[model samples]
Target chain A: MNLRIIKSGVLDTVQDQGRYGWQHIGINASGAMDRFSAELANALVGNDSAQPVLEMHFPAASLFFEQPSLIAICGANFSAVLNGEPVPCYQPILVNKYSILQFERLNQGARAYLAIEGGMNIGKWLNSYSTHLKAGAGGHAGRPLSTDDEIRLNSSVDWQSYLERNEFRVLPWRASDFWEKEPVDEIYILPGREFSGLTELSQLSLTGKTFTLTPQSDRMGYRLLGDPLEMQNREEMISTAVTFGTIQLLPNGQLTILMADHQTTGGYPRIAHVISAHHSRLAQLSPAEKLRFRITDYSMAEVLYRRQQQHLHQIRYACQLKLEWFIHAGH
Target chain B: MSLTIPYHIFPLGDSAMTVDFGSRISPELNSAVMKLYHELQLTPLPGMVEAVPAYSSLSVHYDLLYCSRHRPAEQTVFEWMGELLDKRLRKLDYEEIIPSREVVVPVCYDISLAPDLEMLARERNLSVEEVIHLHQAAPYRVYLLGFLPGFTYLGETDERIAMPRKMQPSPVVAGSVGIAGRQTGIYSLSSPGGWNIIGRTPLKLFDKDREPLTLLKPGDIIKFVSISKDEFEDH
Candidate 1:
C-alpha cells in the first residue's frame, strides 16, 4: 500500500522521537518538535510512540490513501477533512482506500502529526526515521514530501465492509486525557547556567515581561524579542553543551529558545530553560505568538513532568483496549 | 583522583544537565571535559541518554519520564543524576588519557581555491606561503564539533595566522578550511559561514553514508597537509 502526496505543505517531513546519541559529533536530534502530540497520534492508532509519522505544517500535504487503514491526527488542528468531510483529531479513524485527506485551514498550532497503524514504510538514517534537513538524510529520501511522492504503508487493514456505508468512520473512543491539558500560554522555565550572569533588572524582566516569537524561528531555535538583556560585565564564554528548551541570551540582548534541532553546543549565555512537560505547548506556538516566562522550582517541574508521563501512559493503555476491539469488529 | 581542574555541575533544564570546567580554552581543560564525557558514556546513570563534550564543558541528556519515575521519591531526577555525576567526578582519574585518533586532512591551497588566503596574509603583514606554513606547523587538537556536522573545531593556531570572523557570512563550499581567531575548522556541509577561508579540502567530511558520519570526533588530533589542485580533484 502506498500513500500518494497530492500537495505538499510547508516543512512537511517524516519525524519520530528524533535521532539521538550523535550530538557529540555536531549531529542534532531532529525529531518531532512536539513529542507528546506525536506520541499521542501513534497511540491513538495503536502504534508505538517511536514509529515515524508525517509531521506537517500549515497548508499540510493532501494525501491519497491507497488502502483501508486506521490512522489518527494530532497536534496542530488544521481542521483535517477526509473526502470533503471534516474529521476530528485525537481519535482513531477508519480511512477507506482512495480517500483524500486534506488540511483545509490553520485553526490552531504550527505543526501536526499524522500517524498510521504499523507506521510508514520509510528508510532510516543513523537508526532514525526523522529527516535531518541540513544533512539531507533520513525519511522519504531525506527531503520534504513533494507532489507525486509515494510512501509505502507497512500494514493495511480491510475496513471496506466496516466503512461500506460511509467514506470513513470516526471511532467513539478518544485520547481525552492525552489531548486535554491546562491551556499553556504561559511557559514554565528554570534558571539556566548563566541566569545569574545577567543584570538584576534583566533577570527580573525575563519573568516579568512578555516576549514575542519572531519569524526568524524554525526547527533550530525560536528567536524571541523583548527587553534587551545585559550582563553585569562583558565576559566571553567558552562554548558548552546546550539542549532542547535552553533559552540563550544572545549577544544582541535578544533571546532564542533552542528547539529539537538545536546545536550540541553554544557560546551564548543560557538564561533559562523551558520545562520538559511544556515543550509540546512551546512547539505548537506559531510564529509571532506572545508568551510569558514563569520561573518555577525544580520540584514543581518534576511533578508536572511526572503528570504528563502518566497522561501518556493512560492514553496508551486506553487506546490499546479500544483498538483491539475496533480491529476485531472490522473483521 | 587527581582532581586538578575546578568544575561545577548544573542542570541545563529538567531533562539535561551540564558539567563545566573553567571558562577558557586549553588542552588541559578540554581533556578534562572529554574525560568526564567518556566516563559518563561508559557508566551512564539510570535513564542517561547521551553526553556531549564541548570546549570546557559536557552536557548530559536523559530520559525524563524514566528518570522521574525511577529515581528515589525524595530526590528529583535532577538531584539524583547530579549526585551520581558528583560521585563519578569525585572518583574520576584524570591520569589515564583516552587514546585520540590522529587524522590527516588534505587542503588544496591554490590561489584560485583559496579565496581569502591573500587577504589574510596581507592583513597580517606576511606572505601567503608564510600563512600556510604557520597553519600547518602544529598538530591541533579537535576540542569540539558544533555549529555543523563534521565541522570539527581544531584549536590553538599560530597567532600570526589568526584572524577574526568575516563581518558578513558568505556562501562557503564543503571542505573549506577556515580560521576564526585562534581556532580553525573544516566546513562539513556547504552553507553560509563567516570564517576566513584559506583553502578547501577534497575529502568528504560529512557524508551520512560514511561510517561514523563525521570524519573527526572530539579528542582527535588532526593536521592539515598541503596539496596541489590536481591532487584535490584526483580523489
Candidate 2:
C-alpha cells in the first residue's frame, strides 16, 4: 500500500519512539512530540508501539491512498474527511485505492498522528526512523514531507481482516484506553537540578501562578509568558546535558519548557522537570493556552507514572481480548 | 588527602535524573562524571534507560514504571541510586581510560570568512598574525558537545585570543570558527551566534549518513590548522 501527498500541510514528518545510545556523541533523542498519541495510533493498527507514523501539525494534510489499507488517526481532534464525508477519529478504518483524505484545522491541540498498518517505509538512522530536523537525519531524506511526496508501506501486508472488521466507524472502542484521555493541562513537575536556586517566595509562586503558553513554541521548547520568577543565584553555569520537559529558569526570570527536539545540552539553571505523566499535555498545548504547574514529590511522581503504565498494559490486554472475541464471534 | 566530592542527585525533568558531582568546572569533576557514567551503564538499574554524561554531572533517563516495580518500599529510588553511585565511585579504578579519537580541524584564516577578524584582533590588543599564532599554539580538548549538532565546545581557550562574545549576536554561517571565554567552537549549522568570529573551516562537523556521524568526540584533542581560502574550498 502507498500514500501520495496532495497537500503537505503546515508540517508533517515521520517519527518513531526515539534514537538512543548516541547522546555521548551529542545527538539529541529526537522523536514524536506527542509520544503517547503516536504510540496509540501505532497500536490501533496492530503495529508495534515503536513503529514509525506521520506526525501532522495543525491538520491541513491531504493524501491519496494508492491501495486498500487499514489506517488510524489519533491525537488531537482534527477535522478529518474522506471523500467529502466527515470521518471519526481515534479508530482504525480502511480506505480503498484512490481515496482522498483531508485534514482540516483543529479546534484544539497542535499536533496529531496518522498510522498506516505496515508503518511508513523509511530509512532508519541509529535504529530510529524519527527525523531530527536540525541534524537532517532520518525520515524522508531527513526532511518534512513536501507536496507530491509519496510514502509507501514497509511490506505488502494485507488488511482484508482489518478492513472487514472495521468498515463503517471505529469499533465501539476507546482510543484513550491504550493511552490517556484525562484533562492534561494541569502539568505535574518534580524539583530539578536548579530547583534550590529559586527564592522560597518564587518557589511558592511557581505552584501558585498560572502561565499561558506563548506563540514562541515548537519542538525545541515552549516560551511561557507569566510572572517573572525570581532566582537565588546569578552564577553562570558550564554547559550540561538537558532533555525534554526541563524547565529552565532564565536570567530574566522566564520559564522555558524544553520539548522533543530540544538541544542536547544547555547552561541555564533548571528549576523543575515536568513529570513524564504530564508530557502529553505539553505536546498538545496551543498558543495562549493557560497552564499550571503542580509541584509534587518524587515518590508521588513515580506513583503517577506507575499508574499510567498499568493503565496502558490493561488497555493493550483489553484490545487483544476484544480482537480475539471479534475473530470467534460468528462473522 | 583527597577531599570528599560534594554532589547532589536531582531530576532534570520527569524522566531524567541528574547527578551533579560539583557546582564548579574542573578536570577532576569531568573525569569523575565519565567514570560514574561508565560504572552506571555497566550495572544499570531496572528502569535506567540512558545516561547523558556532562562536564560536572551525569543525567540518567529511566522508565518510571520499571523503576517503581523494582523499587523497594524501604528504600527510595533516589537514595538507592545515590548510594549505588557512591559505591561505584569508591570502587572505581582510576587507572582505566576510555578510547578517544584524535581529530585535527583545518581552519582558513581568510578575510572573507573571518568577517570580524580585524575587529576581534583590535579588541584583544593583538595583531592579526599574533591572534592567529596564539589560536594555533595550543591543542584544545572537546569539553562538551551541545547547542547544535556536532558543535564541539572545546576547553581552555588561548588567553591571548580569548575575548568576550560579540555584544550583538551575528548570524553566522555554518563552519564559522569563534571563541568566547576559555572556549572555542565551530558553528556546525547556520545559527544566531554570540561568539567572536575568527575564521571558518570547510569541515563538516556533522554528517548524518556517516557512521559515527559527528566528527569530534568528547575527550578528543582538536588542533586548528591555518589554511588559505583556496585550500579550504579545495577540500
Q: Considering summed lDDT, which 10 consecutive residues are worst modelled in model 1 chain A?
A: A176-185
Tens-digit per-residue lDDT, A258-315, candidate 2 = 9988888888888888887777778989889989998888787777777766766666
lDDT of 1 at A168: 92
Query: Which of the numbered candidates is closest to the native, going by highest lDDT?
Result: 1
DockQ of each: 0.84, 0.67
- Which clashing pairs does model 2 show? B157-B182
lDDT by residue (tens digit), candidate 2, B1-235: 4445667776565556778887666766777777777777788755787888888878888766666667678866666565665666677665567666678889998988898889888988999999888988888777677787777787777777788777788799889899988778888888888998889989988787776688776677888899998999999
Quote the positional error of residue B143 for candidate 2 in Å: 1.0
The CA lDDT at A127 in model 1 is 86
Candidate 1, pairs of clashing residues: none
Give lDDT: candidate 1, residue B67: 87
